[model samples]
Target: MLTVDFDRLGVKPGDRAIDIGAGAGRHSFELYRRGADVTAFDRSADDMKAVAEMFAAMELEGEVPADARACAEVGDALELPYADETFDVVLISEVLEHVPQDVRAIEELTRVLKPGGVAAITVPRWFPEKICWALSDAYHEVEGGHIRIYKADELAAKLTAAGLTIRGRDHAHALHAPYWWLKCAVGVDNDDNVLTKAYHKLLVWDLMHKPWLTRSLESVLDPVMGKSVVFYVEKPVVPVAAR
Candidate 1:
């Protein structure tokens, strides 16, 4: 279920981590479970409230470490509320395409990460996303839908320009791509279409069961048709002379 691989990102216990654009707090919950002091930041107040409640529920169920702290904050990505160099780790997953000024948002993410801190960013990969756009205007033309498609190189350049050094990269969720194509071909909003409904059921089963066959197939397909591309980056420590 995680697009950003935490092990590859080097997430550790006690790290101060922020999940920017943390819709539904999936990544935030994972961070908390890993014993991070986690913050789930988003623009939606109602979503933040739900996230906060979930964090509290996790605490009550002893799912999180006693010392692990987490909270939800409603905020703008272009203007993060935290001070510069505050967090040890940052996660911006499936979010950049929604921001018109994505570069500014990247700059803000970089500014808040402490020097040497790492971030994991994920986005919809170009070819699959392009296919979705071509199939359905409703997919991209919605009120808060994706605004742009990013070629891997273009995204890497933008992050480099913002002073983050790319450390690693990978593709994920190859099995889910065709399901989306089906949705777009039917109707993005049409949940009742037989093909779309069947595909959705299959995806749900794959998620819950994670059978070896589908997993193996997805691994084989990931490099070629993965729906999302992930980048791991680090903010370099400034030399004393520069300071």
Candidate 2:
């Protein structure tokens, strides 16, 4: 499922798009399907390999448009390999909170986006994340788990300071918030817990079936308690003077 709405971000066919920290390449795959020239970059060698394999599979199946191109790269978020103004669109979803130098990562993202290019950044929302932290330290203590929680304003402010003009913000995945809470309460690794198992099944069903009732419910509840807060931004034509 997509946390950032590509339509709202104004992503178009033939756009050069980068999915930073593309864990399983969800956003990258979507961009490719939309006829973008897509790149999925992450530090994990395994993830990059998997993303490459998926890309190859898509190519064999003719899943992407003939004009769409895609590839995977292993790279750091703080020092992306691409040159400045390289991409027309960028997506950094559910990743900043895991980066210790999040501002630097933001700078890297902004540096690579072409003038007037848009980006979508998603992070765990503060309140629900705070509750999870209160309930279980393990939620934030793991090697690559979330190191920070972001209030919407704080994130937007950071992006603005890094040279992006924040355009819009929204919450997403409301139905999935309870899944994380349950995981934290039981055990982050304990997928066998009965309640967790049941919830997982429901989530799987929701993702696959997408019943209208649940979709409408999630649309209503997303603004209030969604787990991820997504912000849309554009790199201005001219960089603002550093304060």
Q: Which candidate is the best by lDDT?
A: 1
Clashes of each: 0, 0
Worst 10 residues of 2 by lDDT: 234-243
Clashing pairs in 1: none
Summarize candidate 1's per-residue lDDT along 207-230 as a digit string, tens digits.
Answer: 899999999999999999999999
How well is each residue in 26-123 modelled by candidate 2, as lDDT tens digits? 99999999999999999999999999999999988999998889999998999998899999999999999999999999999999999999999999
Most TM-score-accurate candidate: 1
Alpha-carbon local distance difference test for all models: 0.96, 0.92
How well does model 2 score by local distance difference test? 0.92
